[model samples]
Target: MSLRAYLHAIARCPSLEQLWETHTQRMAEYGFDRLIYGFTRYRTSTSLGDPEDFVILTNHSREYTDEFLHGGLYFHAPMVHWALAHDGACSWAVLHDMTRERAMTPEEERVVEFNRRMGVHAGYTVSFKSISNRSKGAIALTAKPGMSQGQVDAVWAEHGSDIQLMNEIAHLKILTLPYSTPSRALTPRQREALEWVGDGKTMQDIAVLMGLTSATVEKHLRLARDALAVETTAQAVLKASFANQMFVMDV
Candidate 1:
C-alpha cells in the first residue's frame, strides 16, 4: 500500500482488530516480516499484575509473543528500555551503535539474544503517553538485519505524526473501556463545567459565561473533579482533554 493509503487506513480503524490489520498490511508493504503493536499502561493500578493493559494488535507469531511475555524478556529488553527513554524516531541499529561502547549487562545480553533468535535483527520503536504523561508506553516494529536505516527514516518521516495520533487514540480507547472496578461517569453539568475549564476559563469567568452563581460553578467544578477521580480541577481538565472529551479554545 502507498504511504498515504497506509496512514488513511490507520486513521480510519475504530477497533483493535482493524488497527492491527491495517498495521500488518502496511508492514508488508514496507517489507517487514514481523510487527508487534502494543499499548501498555506503565503506571496504572492493574499494570503490575496485567502487563498488557491493551494490545492494539500484532502479526508476530503468537508462540514468540507468549514466550516473550512468559520469560519476562520485555522488562529487561535494552531496546524497549531505550525506546522509553528517548523521544522522536529511533532505530535498533542506531541505538546499538550509539551504546556499543558501554558493555551490556548479563541480563541485557540475554534479552538481546532472545530478540536475535526471534529474527529481529533490526527494528524501530516509538514511545507515547496518555493524558497523564506519567502513564507512558512504546510501540515497536521489528525487521530483518538487511534493512537500511535510510528506509526506516523515510517511513518515519512520512508516517510519524499518524503513529503519534494512533497512539493517542489507543490510549483513549483503553481509558473508556470497561474496567473491573467501575468508575463514575461525568454528569452533563459537570462535563460542561470541565469543558469550560479545559477552554481556559477561570471559575469567576466560567460562572459569568454559564450564567450561574460562583458557588454553583464551584460545585460543578468539584463534581467534575470527583467524576474524573482527579485531585484538582487542573488534573480534571487534563484528563478530559486526553480522553478527547474537551478541547482547549484558542482564546
Candidate 2:
C-alpha cells in the first residue's frame, strides 16, 4: 500500500483485528517480520496497569507472547524499562552498548538472553508520546531472522522518519477505538443500571425510571459490579468511565 493509504486505513480501522493485520503487513514490507504495539492509560509507579486492560496488538506467535507477556518476563525487559523512562525511538544497539559498558543489570541480561533464544535478538523500540504521566504506549519492531542489527540499523537510517510517523499515527488511532477486557464488558441492562447509578440515582429511583422493580434494579447493579470485577458500585462506575463505556449517548 502507498504510505497515505496505509495511514488512512489505520486511522479508520473499526476493530483491533483490521488494525493489527494492516499494521503488521505494512511493517513486514519494511523487513520487520514481527511487530507488537502495546498501549495503556492506567500506568502507576509500580505497575503498567492490569494486563487485561492493555491494548496489545501483535503479530508474534502465541508461544513467544505467552512466554514474554503472560510469563511475566515483560516486567524485567530492559527495553520495556527504557520505554517507560523515556520517549521516541531507540535502536537495540543501545542494548549492546549497555552490555559492553557493563551497565545492564542481571535481570536485563536474562531478558536479553531469553529474547535471543526466541530469535527476538534485533530490531528497534519506539516509546510513543505520552500526553499525561499516567499514560504510556510503545511498539517493538523485530527484524526478520538472519537480519543483523547492523543491517536493520542501515534500513532505519534511510526510512526511520517514515517508520516513526506510521507508528505514531497508529498509536493515536488506536486510542480512539473502544477497548475492554472480555469479562469487563457489561451487558446492556448492567451498563444502563450503572450509568444511572453514576448519574446519582438510588436503586429504587432507577427502578422507577426504568419501569423495573427495585429488586430488578439491584440485580442489574450487582451484575454490573461483577462484570466489572469491582467490589463496589462506585468503583464499577469509575472503571466503566475509564473504559469509556459510561454516559455514552445511546443511538
Candidate 3:
C-alpha cells in the first residue's frame, strides 16, 4: 500500500495487536524489520511509572526483549537517553561515535554489547512530541540484519519525511485507544460506570443511567478504584482517563 493509505490504516487500528502487526510490516518496507513503539503518562520526578503501564508495541525477538525489556536493561540504554533528551530522529551512528571517542561508560558498553549479541546494531530512534509535560513517547526502528548503519542512513535520507509523519500519526492514534496494565484495565461495566462519572455523573445518577441499583453502582466504582490503584471515584476518573480507558470513541 501507498504511504498515505498506510497512515490511514494506522489511524484506524482498533487494538494494539493489530497496530503492532501493521506498523512492523510498514517499517519493514522501509528497511527496518523491527519496531518498538512505547508511551507513558505516569512519569514523575523520580520514576518513569510502572512498566506495565507503558503502551509497548514491538516486533523484536523474544530473546532480545527477555534480556532488554524484561531484564530492565532498557533503563540503561544509551539511545533511550538520546531520545529523552532530543525531539527528532537520531542515527545509531552516534552510539558508535561515542564509543570511538571513549565516551560510553562501562554500563553503556554492556548495553551496546547486548545489542550486538541480539543483532540490534543499526536503527533510528524518534522521540515524539510530548503530549503533556510528564508524558513522552518514542519509537525505535531496527534495520534488518546485514543492513549496515550507512545503508540505513541512505534509506532515511530518501524517505525520512514519510517515516516521521507515519510515526507521529501512530503516536496520536494510540492515545485514542484504551490501554492499561492488565492489573489496571477496568471491566466493561466498571468502565461504563467510570465513563458516566467522568461525564460528571454521581453514583445515583450512574445507577439510574446504567439500570443498576445505587449500591451496585458504588460497588462498580469501588472496584474501578481498586483496579486503578486509586482512592476515590474522582481519582479513578483521572487515572482511568490517563490510561485512555474512559471517554474513548468506538471507532
Cα RMSD of all models vs. native, in order, equals 8.4, 2.2, 1.8
Which pairs of residues collide in model 1? none
lDDT tens string, model 1, 150-215?
676676668656655654454345444332112445666777888888777888998998999999
Pairs with backbone N, CA or C atoms under 3 Å apart (clashes), candidate 3: none
- Give me the overall lDDT of model 1: 0.63
Candidate 3: misplaced stretches above 4 Å?
Answer: 249-251
lDDT of each: 0.63, 0.87, 0.87
lDDT string, candidate 3, 38-135, tens digits? 78887777777778778888888898889898898888889987877789899999998999999988888899999998899998999998857788
Error of 1 at 112 (Å): 0.5
If scored against the real structure, what TM-score would every candidate get? 0.57, 0.90, 0.92
Q: Which ten residues in a row have the lowest lDDT in candidate 3?
A: 242-251
User: Clashes in each model (backbone N, CA, C under 3 Å)?
Assistant: 0, 0, 0
